[model samples]
Target: MPRGGIGRHGLRPPPRRFRCVTAGRDYRDVARTQWWRAAAGAWLLGMTLEYIRYRIAEPDRAEFEAACARAAVPLASAPQCRAYELSHCEEEPGSYILRIDWTSTEDHLKGFRASDAFHAFVAEVRPYVRDIEEMRHYAPTRVAGAGAGAAEDTAPNLYEWAGGAEAWERLTEAFYREVHRDDLLEPLFRHMDAHHPHYVALWLAEVFGGPEHYTEERGGFQRMADRHLGKGITEQQRRRWISLLMDAADEVGLPADPEFRSAFTGYIEWGTRLAVANSRPGAGAAGWAPVPKWGWGVAPPRRS
Candidate 1:
C-alpha cells in the first residue's frame, strides 16, 4: 500500500454492475438501443452544421476595418451562407468576431475550405492577421428572435449618424491617430506595425471584406494604464491631453462633418464621465465600461 492508494496503479476500479442488468437485455434490444442512440447523435451533428463562428484579432483598428471590408466579397459569394455579419467587441476596440449561419455542414465545407474564392482571398488577406479561431455549434444558444413582420431591424444604432460603416471608420481612425498620440495611447501603436506593408493586404480586406483583421486579448486596459499613471500623467496633464485630442479631431477632418462633430462631442462627454468614475478609489477596480448601442442619428423611415 503506497500512501493510502487503494489500487496498485492509483486508479479506481470500475463500479460493479448488477447481473439483472445484463441478463435482462437481449441482443435485439441492445441493437435497437444502439441504433437509436446513433441516430440521435447524427441529429445533433446535423444541427452543428447549421451554425459557424469565427474569432479574429486585429491589433490595429484601422487595418482591421480595412480587412473586415475585404473579407466580405468572398463571404458574399459563398453559397452556403444563409446569414452573416461582423461585430466589433463592445469592450475591446480592436477585437472582431464574425458570425455566420449555413444550411448544412457539407454545404459550408463545399463553399469555404473547398472553394476557389477562399484560396484567392486567403492569399490576399493572410499577412495582416494574427490568428483566426473557428467553431461549429449544434444550436445558437444566443440569437435574436425572428420577428413576425413587425419593425425592420437596422444596423448598430451607434453607427447611424456616422453614415454607416465607412464614415465611422474614416472618422474614428483619423481622429485616433491625430489626438490619442500621448504615452497612454502610444503603447498600442508601438505594438502595432504601421510601416509594415503586409497591412496592405489588410487594407484590401477593409475595402473588400476578407479575414485580414486580428483581435487582441481582451481586458486589462486600466491596469496597464495604472502601472504608468503617476510616472507619465497628472490630472492636469490628462485634461490637456483630452483637449489635444479635440484639436486633432479638427486636424484630421472630423470637425468638417457635422455628424461626426456631434458624435465626437457625445463620445468625449461620455469618456470624461468614464474617467471620473475610474478616479474614485476602489470603484469597479476592473475599470470596465458599457458601450451604448443607440446612435445620435435619426432613425430611418419605415416601409409599409
Candidate 2:
C-alpha cells in the first residue's frame, strides 16, 4: 500500500488508472484490468505511426488534398514507409488527418528523411507545413484495426453489378428457354413472341437500375400489365417462373454472391406476385402505376 488514502490510494500507478492514491479505489476501480496496458506497448509488428494533422481554410482544402495526393506517391515508394492515409474530417471539413505507417521511428527519421523520396514528398507538402497542427510519431496501440478500405473504391449500383444490359439479355433468353420446356409454365407462354425474351430483358434492366429504354421504347407499365391481364397467372405458374429464372441465373453465370442474389430474388418474388394479382379477372392496381425501379432489396452488395 502506498502512503496517503484519497491522494495516494492507487494500486499500480497513474497511467495504470488507479484512484488518486488518497481516493481509495472509488467507483472507477479498474485496477484489475490493467494487464492490457502492460501488454499494449509490447507491439506485434513494431511499426510506428506518424500522424500529421492540418487545419486549412475551406478554400484551400481541394488544393491541399491534391498536394497531399502528389506527396503520398513518394511516401508510398519510399523503402521505409509502409502505408499511409490522408482523410478529411467529415464533421470538421477544414481539418485533415494524415497517418503514415513506418517500419520504425528511426527508419522514418534517419532513413526515409535522408532519401530522394523524402525530397519529392517535402516539395509537394512544404507549402502546408505551417498549417500542420501536429506532426509526431506514435507507437501503434495494436488495438487499432483497419477500416473499410480506401474511399476511391466506390460501390456499384445493382444494374452495374449485374454485368449491365448484356447480362440481363442472356439471363432472360436462357430463362425463356427453360420456360419453353417447363410444362407448368409452357401453356401460358406458348404464344410468347420471338422477341419476348429481349423485351423482358429491357424491362428487367430498367427495374434493376439500368436505362429507361423499356419505358421509352416499350409502353412501360400499362403495356406490361396488359400482357398478363387476361392470362390469369396462377400461383403455381408464378413459382415455376421464379424457379426457371434462378436456374437461368446459374446457367448464364449471373452474379451468385448472396447480396446480389437476395436483391435479385426479392424483385423476382415481388414482381411475380404482382403479375399474379394483375392477371386475375379484374385487378387494376398495376395498370397505372409507374414502372418500379428495383434496388438492392434486402442486402446490397458489399462495397469498399
Best candidate according to lDDT: 2
lDDT of 2 at 17: 24
In order, the Cα lDDT scores of the candidates are 0.39, 0.68
Cα TM-score per model: 0.30, 0.49
- Expressed as tens digits, the lDDT of each residue in 218-284 for candidate 2 is 9877788777887888888888888889999999999999988987887788778867877898765
lDDT of 2 at 26: 29
Give per-residue CA lDDT, model 1, range 64-174, as digits (tens).
Answer: 445545766776687765444444444554444444545566676765778876776566457654545554434322222212331123422323433444544554455
Question: Which ten contiguous residues of candidate 1 have the minimum total lDDT?
Answer: 1-10
Per-candidate total of colliding backbone pairs: 16, 9
Judge candidate 1 against the unseen true structure and give its global Cα lDDT, from 0 to 1: 0.39
**Candidate 1, position 90, lDDT:** 48
Which regions of candidate 1 fall more than 4 Å away from where they truly are? 1-59, 141-304
